[model samples]
Target: MPDAKPAPAQALSAPQKALLKLGLTRDIDLALHLPLRYEDETRLVRLSDARDGQTVQVEGTVTHQEITLRPRRQLLVTLDDGSDTCTLRFFSFYPSHQKALAVGARVRVRGEVRGGFMGRTMMHPAFHAAGGELPDALTPVYPTSAQLPQAYLRKVVASGLARADLSETIPPELLGSLQRVVHGTWTLRDALRYLHHPGPDVSLDALEDRSHPAWQRLKAEELLAQQLSQLTAKRERDALRAPVLRTAPGGLHEQLLAVLPFALTGAQRRVGEEIARDLARPVPMHRLLQGDVGSGKTVVAALAAAIAIDS
Candidate 1:
């Protein structure tokens, strides 16, 4: 039988294109894109109980709505929760918004409430159809571009978090050591899930300051990955063969060290000798010479280069 042709790839949607622009092509990428902050939408507040300068979500019925031109064309909506009424103002709105927020429709709106000449008001608040069960966890507000809406991003991120392979890359023994250091027992998947949609009871301050167990786990993992990457690179370099660039007896390296204007410090001399020994070998040298400002690192480098040139 003849070999079958491969199926063609499907086109990406607008949201998918936006996700691609954000470098979120993989499920793992989406899972790792944590929220910038969280919003408490797990509970609702009465309109009467909401205070000025407080960000709150309230459910109410739209009693009256009108397009007023007094302040350069704005949509003014009066939302009544029976206890009190608040005005929902929108300077820039569409016909769809007017249709959705029609009079007598029950809606839940969230925004910072303010006291104005028009009584309690929320300027350009987010509103949706009311009566759905509130979320059990805080609403995560992720960093996003203009093309990608929060609703769409949240849905896709949840899907990615569920589908991504979250197996532990580090061994159990190493994880135990790290847990002891960080005093955290959270696994990679648990940390991600907790960070993505933290419970209402979790301390906001701890999360903000990165002192939470989940944050600690992520930090420890990131550091471990960086160390592993460096170790792998060093091992790969060590396996490669190179020309043995040895310093000959009384050659440029010796001449440079002997004739230098300033005397080499004990540390500098020790580092220089180490570099010399490494250069004499048949493998790549991967050593870093670190010192404070005004230290003799420059002299050590010059000495090493002299050995290289003589070889």
Candidate 2:
């Protein structure tokens, strides 16, 4: 049988382009847009049972909203779930915000509870309009700008994933090697899927800690790519010839060490020996010496310089 033809890429909608400020023009780009955080909407808490300082999610109707002045200009909103009433105060707000929280509109909000002048308050909560059935999975919250709505971005991402037709970017042999090393089982696509929309069965703790197998798989691939890049560059550099300097025994390096008032730490001595070895080698040295302040790196560098000069 003839192999099925590949699907053509879809152009981003005007709204989607605007929402994705990072210019995620390709399907792979959208796939790589990792969530900044996850919102678990499997269960909703009653406003009345919510405690101060706890971060919780609640569904409620906007009972009232009014612009107030005196203590300071602010927007006050009253939200009532069947269980209890809470205030949603906005010190920084605009007319559009007020319009969104019109009376009787149902919304889901997640925020840290703080005691306020108007009883229980959630000052600057992350919110979304609600009415449809609650999801049994974690909702990815992407990095967003003021102009971009979360819902709009979510829609764009969903569309991208559905139509992406993404081919495997990582070679199967390399993936297998990585899996053998880490005991991870997720594929690249699976990792992206789980990260963007984790099912209820997935451990929330692991997701938050970024220790989930899927996350680990993706992170490992990224690290492997970086390591491969470095190794390739090193190989290329090693191919080039460098001047070899064979220093005489009891050279200037030994003379400088004899005159120094302070003793060198073991670490300093080790680094000096390594640098001297590099200087003697025919290949150019590409070593990075990093140490905390007052670690005597300067002294080691000076010693290396003496070896270079004496040779």
Candidate 3:
């Protein structure tokens, strides 16, 4: 069966939909929803650099469209952006996009450059089809998995983009002060809006505008959540009363250290503190140790074994 997304228990609110569409997740696992990396596609390169078949993204006008008489059933598109020109060939494409590639129209093409033909570079490439005209913007190439169709995934992002009333989880006073401190910064909402709808109006420069605070906010939230969880767990563990182990601390330790061939290292001192703490607790020591040969570990092991036997 296709991995059917479990039906939403209730109609998802707008914020929830955006999270789902981004593939942040279908379930509410906060940690997993964090973005892996921020992909910046702000710079548009020239065609001359593409001569040696470089993988690049550039805006070019369609000079020619020859759908027939080609043996491999590929699109022969002569593209130029006033500065330079290159040939884009798409081998086996959905015929549906044929009408969109009218001659003399401007489009943005992203793909790899192939070998030169008659001194001009060729780009036998896989590209996103531009509609109407090239969008003036930096496009976000989301982390995609093989299971999702690219077209369908784009549509899913569009549908989930409808903004619902959502809270800016950060304190309003802090957010406002930061915006005022940094003049001309995109508000948190604006960045998320463009992130979902990266089309003609949103420019590449705008995406990378240092003033955009979305990334900082998201990163801070994730870090704080993780730290809070760890602290809470530690507090819970500390609250449990531990049974005090009856052993002459320096007496046992001094004898063990003397038996070792080499003096104890700094790491051994710190680790000894930890293991000693765990052993003193009434609970069974479930310490998973990274032991090494001849690390004075034998002494520590003997002492722990003696604890169980003597108790």
Instruction: State the lDDT of candidate 1 residue by residue for 219-309, as single tens digits.
Output: 9889988999999998999899989898888999899988989898888888899998999899999888898988988889999999899
lDDT (10s digit) by residue, model 3, range 173-216: 67676555445354545545555544544434544552334545
Question: Residue by residue across 142-174, what tens digits does model 2's lDDT show?
Answer: 977766678877877877876776566678777
Per-candidate TM equals 0.87, 0.72, 0.56
Superposition error at 4 for model 2 (Å): 44
TM-score of 1: 0.87
Look at candidate 2 and tell me the lDDT of residue 80.
89
Task: Name the weakest run of 10 consecutive residues (lDDT summed) in model 1.
Answer: 177-186
Best by lDDT: 1
Clashes per model (N, Cα, C within 3 A)? 0, 0, 2
Lowest summed lDDT window (length 10), candidate 2:
12-21
Candidate RMSDs in Å, in order, are: 3.2, 7.5, 7.9
lDDT score of residue 206 within candidate 3: 44
